[model samples]
Target: MSSTQHTDTLKNVRTISTLLYWVCAIAIIFQILVVPLVWYAPGWVEASTSQMTVSLADLHALSGWQKYVTMAVMMIPSLVLAYGLYRLRKMFGAFAHNAIFQPEPIRHLKAFGIALLAQTLIKPLTGAATSVLATFHRPAGERVLSIGLSNAEASTLFLGGLIIVIAWVLGEAARIDDENRSFV
Candidate 1:
């Protein structure tokens, strides 16, 4: 590529990276703050839980402190996802500064990958916990403890593994580039 073309491409990358960084930041904020508040709205709760295939009857039965606790339990995966987004924001920030192949970006990429895997693993447990919390008000035989794994979780696991491998490759490339620079 011509020097001008390369420079323009990097400029475009920087602009996109900056946009992604802000998007990640906003997403994290929304997950952490706005989501729990929105959960209190019955319509929103019903819509979201129904989409997840969770029993609306169990959810509707929750009240008072049970609702708060159930909401907290359901937020676990989102919190983990927010942490991953934070790492992604850091990586994008480095890219925005033209530090794409640096250790900082690689580190953030690896951390983000780990966070994704962690969230995948945590999701099922949290789902079960949330179900139990939602139905805990019921009598002993009626309380629910449900565990589920879906294609989405499998896809997340695969994506997380791919990202970790990519981060490893980038780290090796950065190391080689540093070694080559040392000879100059």
Candidate 2:
């Protein structure tokens, strides 16, 4: 492409990246704050948790304290997700400043990938913990300690690995470019 066209494309990338950065920021906030609030509502909780593989019977069995503890436990995955979003935001911020091949953006991408991989593990654990907590008050035989993995988790694992590989490739390319420039 011509120099002017390349410059224009980079400028467009910067604008889009800036917009994505803000969107990620908003998503982080929503994940941290709004999601937990939604859990407090019975209808919302039932609607959301109904899709879970592990049966969560008698969610009402949880006392206020138990519910709070469960909510906190559930926040573990949300916090992980927030961390991933933060890394993504940082990556986008770097891109917005036209730092496409810089180490900072690549680092952020790798971090985000790690966070995604963590979510695959942490999410199932948290779900099990939440289930146990929710059913703790139940009779001994009825108590739940269920652990399950869904397609979503598998997809996350795959996507995370892919992103890490992409980041590695980008890092290598940057290194080669830098070396080539030094030899010129």
Candidate 3:
């Protein structure tokens, strides 16, 4: 592509990077506030107490420690997502600087992909952990444990795989570009 194309592409990437930066910042802040929100404003959460159906009120009604445990359970995936978003923001930043073929963006892409895959793998664990934690104070007969798979998890894994493949392709392209330069 020509220099003008590079400049235009970089400009678009910069715009997208700016948007992603704000989104990640806001998401991080929201994730951090989840505990406080759950503690102070339980209305924001929707959970039921039937073990099969738990509402935010059910979680809110738990003892303080139990609530904290539940919060921790919920925070794990959110934190991972935040970290992924942060990596993606960095990747976009590099792209904005016309660093598409450099190692930095490739590394960021790989990290983000791994992070997403990690989240996909841990989702069931988190759910089980949360269920166990939520029932920490419950009577023996009232306790419950559950785990399952969902389309969202499958989608996440697919996206992660796609990202890793894209990174690999880019890396190969960078190698080819270097080889072509040698011939010049």
**Model 3 clash pairs?**
46-56, 47-54, 47-55, 47-56, 48-53, 48-54, 48-55
TM-score of each: 0.89, 0.90, 0.83
Could you arrange the candidates by TM-score from highest to lowest? 2, 1, 3
Residue-by-residue lDDT tens digits, candidate 1, 1-184: 9999999999999999999999999999986874465455546555455324257556666789988787787788889889999999999999999998899999999999999999999989888888788778888898777888888889999999999999999999999999999999
What pairs collide in candidate 1? Answer: none
* Higher-scoring candidate on TM-score, 2 or 3: 2
Q: Give Cα distance to truth, residue 11, candidate 1, Å.
A: 0.7
Best by lDDT: 1
In candidate 1, what residue range of length 10 has the lowest lDDT sum?
A: 45-54
**Candidate 2, residues 27-82: lDDT per residue as tens digits?**
99988984456555545556666545344445545668897898788788789989
Model 3: per-residue Cα lDDT over 1-184, one tens digit each? 9999977887887788777767767776785776567568755553522222234555667787787778788678768877887788788778766677898888889888988999778767877877777776778888767675778789989999999899888888888998999999
Worst 10 residues of 2 by lDDT: 51-60
